[model samples]
Target: MDTFWKDLEAAAEARDADALTELMRAAAHDGGNGEPLGIRYDAARSARNNVDKYAEN
Candidate 1:
């Protein structure tokens, strides 16, 4: 894995929720407002599912 992706994977594996959240925000920033990279739910099913709730609230 490239340094960036490797770091991301490492953060996810550590169960570092805040780190993963920051990573998502960074990706969205780098990808720009239009075609931004979305969330990465690498840990659990609830993680994937809670995403929409985040947007809605």
Candidate 2:
């Protein structure tokens, strides 16, 4: 397996969003796409809140 895959797996297992985001940014750059990823923190926060709300039930 490639180092990139290993790193990605580790980041995923650790639930490191920043690490995953950085890895995705690097992958995009390497693939010739310079556009920045539009990570919607608001949406993520909303989803997390919903999950937490439901989990509390």
Candidate 3:
């Protein structure tokens, strides 16, 4: 989880939308079939929102 956050932060810092999407997909896949889709969606949303918010600054 920490690694995911760190990588997300880096992607956000770089302002790489592709990397962000790929990371989210990778995270969801890693979460396994038992994991709920909502959780992955939320995680991706949070990361994307944060990146967009900070990009405006």
Candidate 4:
């Protein structure tokens, strides 16, 4: 949704890694495509890793 994007943008601008990860998790869970548990787990893990990697920049 528009709100999600706006919030994500705001989080990114603020360099809030935790908020970014949480938003990614929310999007993955609410996508409504019946994603498999494994896929969701992978996504969350990837999100965390990305947040960590970027936070170092």
By TM-score, highest first, what's the ranking? 4, 3, 2, 1
Regions of candidate 1 where Cα sits further than 4 Å from its true position: 32-57
After superposition, which runs of candidate 2 have C-alpha atoms over 4 Å from their true positions?
31-57
Report the lDDT tens digits of candidate 1 across residue range 1-57. 224466566665565556667666566555333433453323322342355456568
Candidate structures ordered by lDDT, highest first: 3, 4, 2, 1
**lDDT for residue 24 in candidate 4, whole number 0-100:** 69
Give the per-residue lDDT of model 2 (tens digit) for 15-39.
5666666666656445323334433
lDDT of each: 0.50, 0.51, 0.70, 0.62
Model 4 CA RMSD to the hidden true structure, in angstroms: 4.4
Report how far off residue 35 is in candidate 1 (Å): 10
| Candidate 3 pairs with clashing backbones | none
Backbone clash total, candidate 1: 0
Question: In model 4, which residue pairs have backbone atoms overlapping below 3 Å?
Answer: none
Better of 1 and 4 by TM-score: 4
Weakest lDDT window of 10 consecutive positions for candidate 1:
39-48
Using lDDT as the measure, name the better of candidate 2 and candidate 4: 4
Which segments of model 3 are wrong by more than 4 Å?
32-41, 49-57
lDDT of 2: 0.51
Model 3 over residues 5-52: C-alpha lDDT tens digits? Answer: 667678777877778888777776675345666565567667777778
Leading candidate by lDDT: 3
